[model samples]
Target: MPEEFGPVGRGEAIQALSREVLIRRSLDISPSGFITIISIIQGVALGLLAQNTFPKPTVLGGIQSVTLLLVFVSVFYYYLTMSVLLRWAPSFLDCFLPFVIASLEIPPAFFLGNAVAWNAWLAGFWFLTMGGLMITTKWSPVSHFGNVRKAHRLLHDLLRELRYTAGIGGFMVAFCALCAHLIPWQRQGWGIVGAGTVLAMVAMIVARTELRASQIHALYGVNRPPFN
Candidate 1:
């Protein structure tokens, strides 16, 4: 019988090692690294501002404040996520997911301002939770893109696992937001926020999947670049 081999089996181990060494030697500090560092600093500053600006110290209020923090985190996450994609997976269209996810928060912000009567604390809590989830979700591409053929299959598989796990985690966060809005105990305006959150998540998933699938197809010669 023919030998059944994995991705690593396709090439000699020594050759792969040599190539990795050469690639590392040739690589410079990625521009994205600088951007990521700056964004993180900015995010931390924003978080501090939110903490100082909002008063009221209750669990619900905390949730609201958290949600507000999430807004800035989401933007920072998007910046980092895009930077990673542009640096490593330049050919993939996955970089767009962060922007889409970030945009979804705008409507919720407006709704929260206009409709919800919650204290600043609760608003902050919601923002922090939601923003954290969105930003973390955007980081999924780090794993998925790392799965490129050059790395060992083990590395690729690990990245794939991380990507899926993050995706599910993000989905759960959004689902929780949705439920919070829908529950009778919560405010009515939150329902709009919840609905928008769910829809945006769905859209993000679809877009990412489509882009990934297209890349896979290209690899197999079933499709071409430029997507269709």
Candidate 2:
């Protein structure tokens, strides 16, 4: 199995470790990090502005404001969920899910701005999309302590978590759509709260799964661990 990636000696391992350090350092100062900082600042400013402007909003303003806040929160929540829950660099296909999810929010914001109820119905599709992405992704598991069985089991658990995530999304879709249809038209704000709660609960579940999954990467040794 070691030979599969070619024999890794002490020198090669040290070089790998150095390269990993360099990469981490680069990411710390990366343009993406800078952009993320700027985005946080911008978001804070936008929140303050929205708070002042939407205090005494009209019916349309109220709907639009809540929708705007929901979309903003959805974007941050999903990104945080991906980071905290996955804790690994996903494949490109999996990485693309966030962008697709973000783009999907735009339609609800534009076309369904008339009511929170209508927005809740469309919001379900976002979770449905997440479910589909999890179902479709092919995960590559990390070998734990060079144990093939451990690695395989980790992979299985990951798949299981993906399925769990998908199921959560599916449930949320039904839940959101149901809220949209069942709730009285005048009281759709509760539907928005429900959608947010679903997202939060799903995040908690994924976070717990990831906590268990992270055991695969746990290291115990005298020397520093090698770069994976």
Candidate 3:
């Protein structure tokens, strides 16, 4: 096959994208540690913010606010994972992330609700994101100028869409979660949970993403570097 030529981003995820357009990719999993730390900080901040913002919130509201925020931030990172590498069959696990990501405020919809539990889950989930980063870094070099392959093309398209859409969507969703602290939007916690579930279902049904990802992995061998 004839080779295509252009600059691709200098990372594992978006390396297949042309330099003609600006893009970014996950270079490594080292950022995992940073993500964990930041996630905890964000969770704490959210907790404090909720506590200070609304005096009438349930006793658990402060805690749930923080916990749910942690999950939301971590999920952003989860989707962020897809930007770099496609998981072959993590679909089943991915399906359950919504539950893992949050619990409840008034009734307390989750079990094992504790700071330790939240932090542990946050770290664990972030690890998955980091795993994706590591995998993508391994095969990043496979796609490059004058050496673009079919797998690279597919990856390029998928990754760009993943990053842009997920990045934007994550912020919006997080904002929605934050809104719960302010307005009485039908018990904001439930709204966040519902929105998360809807997004997850939509991703599964509309994207039908896992099969395509698995196929790309089988054909391209992204986990193995240089792809050739």
| Residue 96 miss distance in model 1 (angstroms) | 5.4
* Whole-model lDDT per candidate: 0.44, 0.48, 0.42
Flag clash pairs in model 2.
none
In model 1, how large is the Cα lDDT of residue 105? 39
Sort every candidate by lDDT, greatest first. Answer: 2, 1, 3
Runs of candidate 1 with Cα error greater than 4 angstroms are 1-26, 29-34, 37-53, 63-151, 186-228
Worst window of 10 by summed lDDT in candidate 1:
113-122
What's the true lDDT of residue 77 in model 3? 49
TM-score, ranked from best to worst: 2, 1, 3
Off by over 4 Å in 3: 1-139, 143-148, 188-209, 214-228
lDDT of 3 by residue, 28-89 (tens): 33334334544554455456555543655554445555445544544444454454453222
Give stretches of model 2 more than 4 Å off: 1-95, 105-137, 141-152, 155-159, 182-186, 189-193, 196-200, 219-228
Q: Candidate 2 lDDT (Cα, whole model)?
A: 0.48
Over 1-228, each residue of candidate 2 has an lDDT whose tens digit, in order, gives: 464666667656544457778766554444344336435643663555365445565554454455455545544543443343233333454445544554444444343333444445344644655555454334433432254566446545655665565456556645655665576674456455544554564465456444544554443223322221
Clash counts per candidate, in order, are 27, 0, 1
User: Cα deviation of 107 in candidate 1 (Å)?
Assistant: 8.8
Which ten-residue region of model 3 has the weakest summed lDDT?
A: 103-112
TM-scores, all candidates, are 0.35, 0.46, 0.34
